[model samples]
Target: MDASTVPGILDQAHRRTTAGLLMLVTFIAFEAMAVGTAMPTAVAELDGLAWYGWPFSAFLVASVVGMVVGGDAGDRRGPRVALPWGVAAFAAGLLVAGLAGGMAVFVAGRALQGLGAGVMVVLLYVIAGQAYDSSLRPRLFGAISAAWVLPALVGPVLAGLVTTHASWRLVFLGLLPLIVLGALLVLSAGRSLTAPDSPPPPARGRRWWAVLAGLGIAALQYAGQRLDLPAVPVAVVGAAALVAGLRPLLPRGTARVARGLPAVVASRGLLAGAFFGMDALIPLLLTSVHGYSPTAAGLPLTAGAVGWALASQLQGRFARVPRERLLRLGFVLLAVGLAATVLAAVPALGGWPAYLTWAVAGLGMGFGMPSVGVLLLEQSPEHRRGADSAALQIADVTLSALSIGLAGVLVAAATQGLLGLPAAVAASIAVCTALALLGARLAGRAAAPPRAAVPGAGTTLAAS
Candidate 1:
């Protein structure tokens, strides 16, 4: 490639697009972080502490459906048509959520936000795939990962301050204008892009499957929150629903981890499941066992995010290294980090070890996550980019929900005297570490052989 033709992410032609994409990701990250911090206060003010979990569950369920719809729309009409509408929906949801008077209204608003976010995020990946060279993709993903850093560090704290002094509503409402600005920037840059000449073969029954999958995820989340025998039945039903719905939505052979694209998709699930499961539990372990304050406990999470950002930046510089190799290295690092983290549960060691150990794990995620995105793009054809991106995200969200649910079950068991708190923590870490190890073992399968490459501007997967 000629030097003049090789456009960097921040070069004049791509600079506005990159900025807009990062801005959108940053706003989403901020909202995600801020909601957890603000939720208790919001629920209390609404006099609906009982319905606290519904807001989150609603979002998760709706997002799955949105992803399917968005992917289909992107493929048929292009991201230009879908992206602005997604932003508008997200902004409207924010408005509704900010002005909500009841728990029902709040949950409804959250569902809207989830749907919009789901659509917007998938379309973002499609835009990246369409607009940039494959060589530039790693850096684009690195920038997206880095965009989470500021939000991870300060979003919760800012939300807390807002909720304490002003109102929790501001947490939702404050980003409206910024979201609009990002949409406008992307819209301007998007003018140069084009849609497919004709829509790909229609995906029969995929939308319905997406809805079923969403409900399944919500049921699982609800079951995780419940602490009684009734939870068992709910969990079983959820699992059945998830299994049925997920098969149609994902690539063929994904469940069995077939080589190439299927394995790449499966790897995402394993990576997310392991990372997020531990991410959700570590703070609880520190606060409950080590007696650390919430702020002190959260420092480790911030450290992890920082490590993730640093590692992502480093990986983006080494594009020649096979992505599958980087992915394996990441999983190994994550497994080691998780294993070391178990020591934090030991009374003799204290929680200080977590700050360092989790940072190592974060480094693993930094490398692994972006590689997954890049690999997915490399394997998918232009027409299928949106659908394939949606599949990758589905795997991530599904596995994350399941892993967290499993951890929750163990925690509930500890509360019921079935095990000690330390035992529960140890068990959860063990499961997540095993998942990371599994990811490492299967990482090689994620790569397509050189001969399998399709000759086109976009890469296509070979069915191995």
Candidate 2:
């Protein structure tokens, strides 16, 4: 389509592309929400209760590798190549998982799925940067966020139904065709687009560093889950490995939160870490403390998803607002929401009040997450987009893993009677709250003047 005739995301010309992207996102969202529901049954049937957490850990670690490799490939060859491969791998993973007779095989399948998911996420962002102009990006992201709403609301229920009537295997088997359908849509959209000229291949050394980083992240996740072991030494080794590997993978000065793009990247991690840390705990608090059923406990999560969609729509509608301002507002809301969730630890406020509090946290995520995405695109040069996108994902995933790991340790301690449940919950939420406030502080640094650009990179934004 000509520039003048380029239609909106919902217009006829863009309809197929939009539908395909949304459908892909919907399937991913459904799997993410549904897996937790089916896991209990899967473990029971396989007699793999001892290995319950390995599936999740394996997926997460393998995803880090996928992101790194996908980003490099996208920068060198284009997202067109990366996207289809990711979809194929994801589908294969589903088949493997569905057919598995044992836990080890199931974990391997999950790792493959995670790898594919990581690749897809980076490619999707690259696709968004390439296919849509800046004017259309916010709406596209908003739509992506909206796609999660339905899955969040019904995915678990649907998984439970399938498990009860047919088998949990259907949960994996059923998604294979949908993956093919989504891949077809993406490939069709890709046909009309021209690939950007490839940049010089990255140094072989950088690729090695990426592999090391992925391994480190995996080690850290494994260590976190194994807190029952000698905690101090395991944690120390994990931390050292994570830092050593992470140093070479990110932009220079990211560890120090250097102003501009580095700080923006750091802010994404902080926001994700704090938000997801709290999210992981909310259901536990409801079911264990408040005596709610599993389905009933999930209602707050549904409410949170609604709040997220609503906020995303508002940000998309008011695209004129400065992204940094929205980010700051989002962080403030997150901090407040986290603080409010601590009320559930209080005996008098344990039930319904917690739901509203968690919804506010979700609203913050809706605002902050998309704004970070927009800023990443705006800040990155065409050649660096893939690497920058990968960095963003790495930061988000690693920090979230660390945050949840720490919280798990605290919860385990409480369960063993080393601390009161109320105290454990309070302490965990407090740490997350502090991180949210820190993110708000970092948002200002992110808005500062960009550092000197590398040769062939995009022009830096001038400080207003």
List RMSD in Å for every model shown: 2.4, 3.1
Where in model 1 is the C-alpha error above 4 Å? 1-4, 201-204, 450-464
Clashing pairs in 2: none
Candidate 2's residue-wise lDDT over 1-464, tens digit each? 35456557877756777788888889987987898889999989989999998888778777877887777777777887778888888888899899999999999999888888888877777877887778777888888878867798889999999999999999999999997898788778666443557574654565566566666666666666654668667677767777776776676657777666777788889998998887888788888888889878888888888888888887887678888888888899989989998888876775787789888988898898888888888877777677778888888988898888878877888888899777888999999999999989878767646345444233321111
> How would you encode candidate 1's per-residue C-alpha lDDT over 1-464 as one tens digit per residue?
34358668999878888899999989988998899999998999999998988899988998898888888888888999989878988898899999999999999999989988989889988999888888999999999888966799889999999999999999999999998898888889878556788777666578889988888988898898778989889988998888888877787767777777788889999999999999999899999999999999999999899889998898899889999999999999999989999988987778899999999999999999989889988887778888888888899999999999989988988988999888999999999999999999999988874644424322332212
Candidate 1, RMSD to the unseen true structure: 2.4
Measured by TM-score, the strongest candidate is: 1
RMSD of 2: 3.1
Worst 10 residues of 2 by lDDT: 455-464
